[model samples]
Target: MKLYLRFMGIHFRSSMEYKASFFMLGIATMIASLGGLLSLTFLFMRFHTIAGYTFSQVLLCFSTIVMSFALSEVFFRGFDRFEQIIRGGTFDRMLLRPCSLIGQILFEKIEFNRLSKVIEAAVVLAYAIPRSGVIWTADKILVLILMILGGVMMFAGMFLLFAGICFYTLEGLEVLNILTNGSENFGHYPVSVYGKWMLRFYTFIVPLACVQYYPLQYLLGRSDRSWYGLLPLAGFVFTIPCYCFWRIGLKHYKSNGS
Candidate 1:
């Protein structure tokens, strides 16, 4: 952990040396994401609701997913873009280190630029909390918090899996974004608002419905049972396969020896 922190500090220092570029990227991302907020704002203006979900309800779901994604991309993005490290042989530098490759890979990069979304999500969540007007109970808040954590873990696991796939495919980086970034983009609305197929894919396949939809149902008092509130924990399942894939990829990389 100490070595990981040290590597992270180096990356932070590298980014700090280019303060203008960092802030420029941050502003650009915030601007792009504000367009998203405006779109959601107009969406509420049109129908007032979708699939039985209120505007505030959708906003909560969006904010939760965005918050988790932004935090994960901010910190866990080393895994998100690992193909570059692998292709350029930067990964070999980690093998030379006494520390675990996972730790080294984690600390290779830290993009504070991603925090622009985190700040935006925080603002949106803050605005939605009071306006949404839930009864504000411990169980409800816990469900929201748990869903956020589970969503982060699920998405991060996907990113890691995509990185692991690089060991085999060595291309198709953009395709992986269809799972990671696309999920976040689509999550701005209730997963139920999508088709029957999408809901099933996000639930049993990606576990997005487990973390986002079911818990939101519970939080909104739409669910008849307490188990709905606990469903987000199931998102943890995504990480197991992801980590297994990563281990297999690591072995393949070592065996290839190039």
Candidate 2:
């Protein structure tokens, strides 16, 4: 963990070297994230509720997904851009290093700029919390934390899956973006709003509903089942298969020899 922090520190310093560009990009990211919020606002102006969910409830869901995706980009962008390292001969050098390949690759890129999106999400969370009408309790608080952390893990797994695929294809796939970025965009509303089949796909296949929808139901007091609070843990479990797939891809990897 100390080594990871060191890597983060190094990336932070490197990003700070170009302060203006960093701030500009950060502001740009923040602005782009706000567009989703604005659209949601306009939507609720016409309809009092979406699929029986109030604006604040939907905002809670949106903020969680955005915050999670932003956090993943902040820490795991290396996986998102893994093709660059392979094509630039960096992967060959990585193989020669004594450190863990996954760890090294994990910190290959640290996008501090995405912190802007995190901040935006946080602001939305603050606004929605009091208005959402959920009776806050100790367990609800814990579940909320789990929801966000679980979301981060799930998105990180997606990024890792993308990187693993790159080991074979050596280029990023657009379809995978539909899974990652598309999810973030669609997730602004509760997955349940998307209809039964799509909700089932996200729940069973992507497992997004485990982290967001199920736990959200518990948080909103719609379900009294205590087990729903732990649903986010399933999102953490999702990383296991993704990591195994990554290992499989690594085993079959051939050097680009750049």
Candidate 3:
């Protein structure tokens, strides 16, 4: 934990070195995210709802996904861009260190610029809570917090899986973006709106629904199932397999002499 804090402090100071550029890039990212928010706004203006979900309900979902994705990018982008480290031979050097490979990779880059999206998402969430028609309570608030944290875990897992694949390909796969970025885009609305098969794939396969759809149903009072609130825990579980795959890739890398 102390080592992690040290790495974070170094990165924070480095990011602070060029304050103008950092702020400009952060503003750019925030503005870019507004495009989606505007599209959702225009669509809702034309039709009151998507499927049966109210605009605010959809906003709640959007905020959660954007917040989670932004947090994941801020923390796990090193893994997302893991191929670069491998190509540059930095990963080989990383393997020589006595520290955990995952921790080292995690601290290699910390994208504070992505925090702009987190800010935007928080603004949207604040606007959404009262209008989202959710009857707030202790459990509901806890579930909402879990939903964001679980989403972070899910995206981090996706990044891990992407990095694991780089061991064989030696290049980042664009297809995997369909899981990481694509999920965030689609998650603007409820996962159920996608269709049964896609929903099932997200639920049973990727576990996206565990973070968004199921707990959201309980939050909105659409379902009476208390267990729905705990479904987000599955997102944490999803990381186990992803980490195993990463270890397997590490083993392969060691065997192949980088």
Top candidate, metric TM-score: 2
Best of the candidates, lDDT = 3
Given candidate 2, what's the lDDT at residue 220? 89
Q: Candidate 1: minimum summed lDDT over ten consecutive residues — where? A: 249-258
Candidate 2 Cα deviation (angstroms), residue 255? 0.3
lDDT of 2 by residue, 56-142 (tens): 999999999999999999998999998898888899899999999989998798999999999999999999999998999988889
- Candidate 3 per-residue lDDT, tens place, 53-138, comes to 99999999999989999999999989998999898889988988999999999999999999999999999999999999888999
The per-model lDDT (C-alpha) reads 0.85, 0.91, 0.93
C-alpha RMSD (angstroms) for model 2: 0.8
Q: What is the TM-score of each candidate against the true structure?
A: 0.94, 0.98, 0.97
2 against 3, candidate with superior lDDT: 3
Inter-residue clash pairs, candidate 2: none
Q: In model 2, state the lDDT of residue 10.
A: 97
Which is better, 1 or 2, measured by TM-score?
2
Where is the poorest 10-residue window by lDDT in model 3? 249-258
